[model samples]
Target: MRKISPRLIYFFGALGGLLFGYDTGVISGAILYVKRTLDLTALEEGMVVSSVLLGAMIGAMSIGPLSDKFGRKKMVMFAALIFLIGSLGSAFSPEFITLVLSRIVLGIAVGGASALVPTYLAEVAPAKMRGSLTSLNQLMVMSGILMAYIINYAFSGMAHTVSWRWMLGFAAIPSAILFIGGVFLPESPRYLGRIKKFDEALAVLNMLREPAEAQAELQEMKDADEVELGGFKELFSKFVRPALVIGVGLAIFQQFMGINTVLYYAPTIFKAIGMGDSASLMGTVGLGTVNVIITAWAVRVMETRGRKEWLLIGGVGMAVSLVALAILTNFAATGIMSYVTIVAMAFYLIFFCATWGPIMWTMIGEVFPLAVRGVGVGFSSLVNWGANLLVSLMFPVLLQHFSMPIIFGVFAVMCALASFFVKRYVFETRGRSLEEIEATLRDRANVAEDDSVVAGTTPIAH
Candidate 1:
């Protein structure tokens, strides 16, 4: 067989993120039109938009054990197939319940890709380049979102019912591409080693790394394997508790910051402030453009700047922008204020896409031990999807009962809390091999346990 370049591997491996972004972003515009046809109430509109999130929660919860048993590549390919089905089902649905069910199906694929892509990327990458490589998943995700926005705009000029169908159907093309690319991608060598296939693991590593480097890496994995036992139960063990705390905390806070409220409802918000349908769609296109550009820059710098620093900086920037946007929304409903609202939202996207958007997914992949990395990431992803579901489902309903300023202010407060969580709980995994990171975490856990023993208290995964 011919040699396959690592870049190709990264591209195909991260394609799932593209679908994840497209499915999520397309709905922001599609829902505006969808509600007209379905004659949906605020609560029913939330259901149409959030049903996929419900499916994603189920997908994330189950993907870990399934991917661990079958392998990452296979599971990802499976997700792509599901995405293709879901996209088509959604596009062709004739009624309310049918669209909701189709979206839920699509969501399972999104959730699986959300968990699987980062884990696969992290495992295949060299330690020095891991952050940049792993974040390609997020880069692709943002790109997909941008693509969706452009398509949504392209179709927004058409008759309402027809446009939404095209927006949803367009996802099928990318899903098919991801499935085909997955056929050529390599299985993760770390996973190979976990299954006791050392020779196979080394062979795969040699394809990705220098021969000597491959041998050394394989040996390190073997050494680590001797000490760490991986299973679902081990995910909650004292050794893994710290990473678990960080993973789950970031997952929840990322959504609680209310980023999705912007992604899922930007056009709606713009329309609320007195813009026409096309202008509001265009506004989201702007947001998606900013998201893609910032994410691309972030992928270049993540390896150098470190995860914790970016999270902290982005958190502060996001809170400030949201507060500013809330003030704008509270004070003025039309004229130049609508433009100002879009700008403030762009700032929030800049802070988010550059930091938490990519870093949370990247760190979750890095922090988990190889044995339970799939499940650990899965569980974290499950929480992320759950939080996303809550925010997406509630934002419209919240708007029915509360003012826009209050909603944005609440998100600003959550942004501040997320910053605090990062400062107190998050750890840097920059420039460290997966094995090295695991070893450090294990050492810390042991020391903490010893201290707790001395004090006659039990150690927790704090």
Candidate 2:
């Protein structure tokens, strides 16, 4: 059988991210209809909308140890099955309680995929290509979100009144594809080494890398595996805490900046600003389009500009856009104000997509050692999903209590704070091998050699 190239692996592994995007992004549009169909109060609407994130936080917390034990590929496939069940469950729900439960199932899958997909990509990708490849996870995520927008728009005119069901259920198609793809993807080599399948790890790496490069990388992973076990505990000490702070801080700030608020409540926001139902749906589609396009463009530039540099740049841009929205919206309910809101939202997404959108995943995936990669990502992802849950559950309530400008003004403050956090704590992780990143995280400038053997390879079964 021919070997699968790293790029192909990146593409397929990243399918998990599509599920993450669609399940989360679809709700923004679907919630509009859900509220109408179920006669939901704002609080109930928030609970229904945020329940998935609640499940996501749980999934994020649990999947780490499970992935480390069963392997990233298997857990990812499990997530796919979860997503499938969630899609079907959601599509058929007859009441608000059942719908929220269905969404929780889907959220579990999104959380798992979010934690693992980046790690899978970062592990398999050559250091030089890792940035662009792992960025595909975020790219696919936004793509899935954009696709949901299109689907939401397409179903807006359905006479059956089950348009939201279709929106929620459409995720099964991609989940099915991801399940199939997961079956074919290789186990992460870092995982292989952790399990002492050194030969198999070498074989997989050799298949994907040049021989000399493969051998060198194998040595580096061996060095990583030495400290991989229970590495999460060590993160609390002096030098390592900086990396932890950066990783966890980035995750928190990414959510607090209100990306999800816009993503999950754009239709509602637009409707409040006086757009009709169709117009609100179309507006989400427009922002989704902008998100995907900017993400595609950002992946290319991230490699060139370096992760930290671009993160700083993106944070500044995000703050500016949110401040613009807050100021513009505060002026009054002018006809031009609605247009300005769209422009501000679009600019915010552009800045976010170009910066923290993908870089957060890339950075988190790179920060932890081979052993703690799973746990570290899990904890950070839990933070991310938890923050997401808070923002999603509270957005409608906040909207009820405050004007759009005041609400956005709060996010603007958070966005500006995100920039300051990045400026203070973020590291330049661009162009480094995973080994080198581990070195930085361990507070060493270079990798210390560990005793390891390059195992013999057998042809992988197709």
Model 1 Cα RMSD, Å?
Answer: 1.7
Error of 1 at 170 (Å): 0.9
lDDT per residue (tens digit) for residues 1-462 in model 2:
237877677788899888899988898888878888989998999998899999999888788658887899899889999999999999999998999899888888889999999888888888998888889999999999999999999998874459899999999999999999888888888889888888888988987899999999889877663554554565454435666787799999999999998898888888877898899999999899889999998777668887878888888888888888888777664588888888988999999998899999998988876667788888899999999889888887787788877887788888888888888888887889987886675544212111111233332211
Candidate 2 contains a number of clashing pairs equal to 1
lDDT of 1 at 51: 97
Per lDDT, the best of the predicted structures is 1
Cα-based lDDT at residue 147, candidate 1: 95
Local distance difference test, per candidate?
A: 0.91, 0.84
For residue 389, what is the lDDT in candidate 2? 89
Taking all chains together, each candidate's TM-score versus the true structure is: 0.97, 0.93
Predicted structure 1, TM vs. truth? 0.97
Predicted structure 1: lDDT: 0.91
Q: Give me the candidate number with maximum TM-score.
A: 1
lDDT score, candidate 2: 0.84
